[model samples]
Target chain A: MLERSHIQSTGFRNVGPVGERTGFELRLRQANYRGTRLSLIEGVTITVDGVLYPAAHNLVRIGSRVYTPAELDAATETRLAVGEYMTVIVPRPGGLAPGVHWVESAIGYRHPYFPPAHQSAVARDARHATIVMA
Target chain B: MTGFRYGVSLYSYTDDLGTVMTLDDAFDHVADTGATGLEILGETSVPLYPEPPAAWLDHWFAQLERYQLEPTNFACWVDTRIQLDRKLTVAEGAEQIALDLRLAHRLGFKFIRPKFGVIDYNLTPDPIWEGAVERNLDLAQALGIIILPEIHAPTPIHHPVTEGYIAFIERTGTRNFGLMLDTGIFQDRPLTAWGGGDIEAIRKDAPDMVNGIKVPVEHLDDIIRYVPFIQAKFHHVDEDLHDHQIPWERIVPRLKALGYAGYLSSEYEGVRDPWVAIEQVRRQHALIRRLEAEWEAQHA
Candidate 1:
């Protein structure tokens, strides 16, 4: 019966190679609803250093952590140095489906959409951003 | 009518693979029940976690041809624990994605069925949940596959993955990403809780039920375009009455109207009896085939 549960944690690490690739992890319980298995939360989004991950890829890892939106690392946020930790959380191991005691972790892998050599690279603006069901 | 083939998802026989049947045996069983297709769950057909040798690829394909069964799609995964909590790196996860995609391609499957965020009792994404999904999808696209996020219950259609997908496409503009619609979300009632009520009673009682979960019935016009494949998610079957609450009559027609000639695999998730449940899956497939014919007749 628990579809969307919230989770919070601190002192998570930025595991990415660069500060841009770091992420976090969270753990939570699973619940069932109406013959259907449900998880605590949905998907996690990552922002390395300061750059918000345009998509969920290189974003959150499912199953390793306990809750959704789990895992936050420095690499996922704006230009941060290595060893700088961030926060993250995902629903559970089953991906929003009930019946388990698994955790979900999200890690941010710094995106160099701009080549490393391009020192004065201006981060290309996201064409458009939205939050709608596909 | 294209005959609109029917199939049984391999997930049902998760526990007893040796006793129930091999992938080929299951396909044979489906054909015996007069079904034409087969839906392979990744766990049963593919190798386990940690990974398996690439040689297994040919073995699976051989099974598909020997059975004369068309692979509907793959039920791949990226849940909370494996992705979020485990020490596995995103690059490692990408490798898994690539491996699964190759498996799907080798088996002639067009889509991958993966569920959304993991199930934490707390019900929420990891603090950095969004980043993980984005990276997974990125790797999925590289493999020339589509990441079809399943819309199952508890994590209704209104969830972030459902919405984030829209954002993903808009940002990346890739057709390789879409929704894998599961019919169970449309049910109007809670059949049972975790092991307390009568499973059989609920299955029988909700023959025409609809939980009215957030599946976006009203947004079909908008959502249908995003759906590349659909799962005829069924639990039990009434071989005598020839009915189930999955709403195939309503859904099949709508799918056909949208020219959705993709996979319509059957997912049986009841605990009554695994073997009997499989037969019910075949029966359900037969019913779907008949409905497909009728709809085609009217349209043609």
Candidate 2:
């Protein structure tokens, strides 16, 4: 079972070689009530310790495959199911000091039913998660 | 007296499902409520939806038999706007309906509620809904399923969207199609906690929905004949068995008076804390059943 909160602590770690980290990645349980196709998901934005990582710089990894924001717009058949989790990769040169940090995630989901301007309704979640490894 | 069929939609336990609850747990709760029907969203409830594994299929029937419950409605969606840039072609939309109808039939469901993509804040469905549904009418009849599009909150019954649906039924004269009324329209109070979506955006987009649409219960008299199922959409129900948002008191009696014997499937959209929905749904069942019994006893 996934954590109750949308932002999960299980997969929170730095990517690339441990000491020379390229960035950090955090797992987020599917934000919508129902499974949504990848294209329907606009992008995922992350903020850690008040430092913002916009959607444009984040690459979403669902299962083993990773997708860019533009790729998500074209990947119509690929769906992110409920109970499933996606990883948001944020590029930070030094990652973070090994400790607990306040983190937040916002998934911009475009519902076809919603009018044009409000299509991307943000499902936002914030929590403090521990990064055991530096 | 014909009584309303009791049921619970798995929607009540949306956030809880993967966190603290499972499909088996949901069945136990619904059965303990003495609900005879079980409703589920096709995409959310079925693993690897559209093509659930064979083993899961077997487990599904097993659960139904063990719980002594019947499948009532399979909720689905038509992403009319399938992508960020383009809309679903008519063929793609029809295939979507056909796929859901077959799956609903296979799962022993009597109704398939297709939530079509809307074009506006009023929830006016995309134009493709008509052509797509029209193409699938024969298949629905053969499968013994009713295709329902919900008259949800932010959209009243007398509006053009609903009138357009009624007009489609009249023009096509199809028994396979009808309206599914969500009780949220009758909600007269403000919601303190909304689990369904981003609350601030909803407040900005549809204030009427946030405050309450308060569709007069009497309007049920006009459309009761076309409505075959109801999503008892509610927010909060306290220990005293009082719903804070939806007006079930007025809604139930009118349904009873209209002789509506369809399913009142609970859709509890409220505070999303774990295990909250489980208790909330129980309170709703208790609240509605008491109201129903009161109505029946008064008439008797």
A86 Cα displacement, candidate 2 (Å) = 0.4
TM-score of each: 0.57, 0.98
lDDT of 1 at A40: 19
lDDT of 2 at B282: 90
**How many clashing pairs in candidate 1?**
142
How do the residues A23-128 of candidate 2 rate in per-residue lDDT, one tens digit apiece? 9999999978888889999889999999999999999999899999999989987888888899999999978778999999999998887766577788999999
Number of clashes recorded per candidate? 142, 0
Cα lDDT of all candidates, in order? 0.48, 0.92
C-alpha DockQ of every model: 0.02, 0.75
**Per-chain TM-score (chain B), model 2:** 0.98
Best by lDDT: 2
- Candidate 1's residue-wise lDDT over A60-106, tens digit each? 33233322233333122112111112234321221221122223323
Using TM-score as the measure, the top candidate is 2
